[model samples]
Target: MTDPVDRDSRVPALVRLTVDLSALRYNYRRVASVGERTAAVVKANAYGLGAARVVETLRREGCRDFFVATLSEGVLLRAVDREATIFVLSGPVDEESAFAMVRHALTPVLNDATQLQWWRAHRETPAAVHVDTGMHRLGFDYRSFSASIFEGFNVGLVLSHLACADDPPHPMNERQVARFESIRSLFPDAVGSLANSAGALSGMASGMTRAGIALYGGNPFVTRPNPMATVAVLESRVIALRTVAAGEPIGYAATYTTAQETRVAVLGVGYADGFPRGATRDARVAYGASRLPVVGRVSMDLLHVDASTVGREIALGDWVEIFGHTIGIDEAAAWSGTISYELLTRLGGRVARCYTGS
Candidate 1:
């Protein structure tokens, strides 16, 4: 059978990033039915999947709340949808950043006593207060945060981070839930939020749930499959195909030496394109219905795939799929010794993004 035409003829550059809008909407719908208001965490460029576009699409789907990592991120997101309820996860640090919030009407997630004090003294701005349940990254210290901080601040929401909710039965999960309960009791007026993607799946009771990785369909827990699991794999065209003799090496460092004559195809992706270095010769790329194994160490701009098994005439400009429906995000993360979040978010900005329907 002849393979279908898969190349995007308009911009036939070296590479591109394809985003499935339908899959995104599907994932959003799948997780939004938990009875809690879901906010799409588009911080880190929607985990490097093009934040602006994702936000616009989600907003059209009635997603009013959006979370970002920094004031700058909030500003960028606001440019997309000014009316969206945007929260800065990494609360402001200086007068300028704090002022940006008031000017833009962006809500900052106050993480500490200092931020609370700054907000109280400078302006009674609309803001969210984060409680440090277990993650030592950001949030107010429950022991040190004085009641005065809560007394005067215009708290729009009171939220906490879940340390091990992905592990469900982990002790930290219960401890955090208990602590958050106390916080809720203390600030009953403020909207309570504590569940992240994993915590949301844990069936925790919270007012708002932040779906970070799950919005992109990366597993919130281990590398297992479950509901709401999808992946956005990038497919680049193969510009060249050739046959190599036995004992011939592939890629940098001559890391992969062919045992026999091998047919290899050069694909348009590399470390610079967000295909991690470790994914080198061990990773797999797809061409139509054929699965091609990567050969040699991955380069900064390109890599080779062994297509010896497919005896058909493999031509140049064939589409090669990387890290999508076939290869889950968790599996791709394993090749990099990192988590699915990193892989999804760290996708280089150079790649062009195209979205499909759910």
Candidate 2:
């Protein structure tokens, strides 16, 4: 059997993902400038950009707090930084999980009565309380708010999620904020956190702001232009080029046909590499200044780009930017009929991830 390391050294990766730590730090500063205590939400492995590296970068920028979706995610992050406060958004599910959280010095964000009781029974260490302010996903409902239940408990933080913060004009934002304020008042001693990435950018944060997607260069708002710096750049190399006669079909099921004699470049990336297969609608890849529209459906291992404009300038092994400084991630996500969060997190493991600008 061939050694994997030796095989890797012999063959070059077709697709590459470059993460800019400097840009991540810059984004952290931008989110922190929102006038609230900023807590880095490094959940989903920092949105699949590698949690350990992202956490290290954020720590250097003076980020002391971090949030993760699960207890296991918190445990993994705890291994990255011994000092940074890690909050488990899913909280403890049972006794064993609660013990693990206490052992790792992870703070659980109690969402419901069961989690709160679990935390109270196992440990007295400070934990956060999540109040449901209209998202209806997690957190204790506002109608059931009771200060007595947390009388002897050390509630260190009170947070609520914003569902429509991305849609700034949505009336739900104001309503959720109002409900969160009422619930937060009940826990006067605990720190109040009511904003996410979009909320922080739009000046809706309070005591603490949980910055998620925006820190990774994803536009938090739906319509507003992305204000954050670019952090991740995805690129693929051209493996083959061919000339197709007019009326010839290309790719599986012949979804796209050559309207005229056209030059096509076969990229060494596809849905298997996290390039959305459904992005063929209006998706284009960048080669220098020329934008080559993607024609035909994206396959598992390859996709064809209409390189007629670039002509002879394009050659085999030339790299094309899938999304990066030249093409915005949000724009790419739109082409995929998805959101930036999905696009970033869906990046497959086969794609090489390189860290830069540290």
User: lDDT per residue, candidate 2, 135-166, as tens digits?
Assistant: 89999999878878887888899999999999
**In candidate 1, residue 64 scores what lDDT?**
92
Off by over 4 Å in 1: 1-9, 229-231
Top-TM-score candidate index: 2
Model 1 agreement with the true structure over 1-358: per-residue lDDT tens digits: 0001133548655666667887788778767778378899988888877887788788877789999898888877777776888999888897778888888879989887777666765456778989887688888776565546477667878899898867787888888888888877787677889998888876884798888888787788763365664747777778778899999988888988999999998888888877888863456777766677888988888888898988556778867777777766677677678887877666664566766663
**Could you tell me every candidate's TM-score relative to the true structure?**
0.93, 0.95
Q: Which residues of candidate 2, in runs, are more than 4 Å off?
A: 1-11
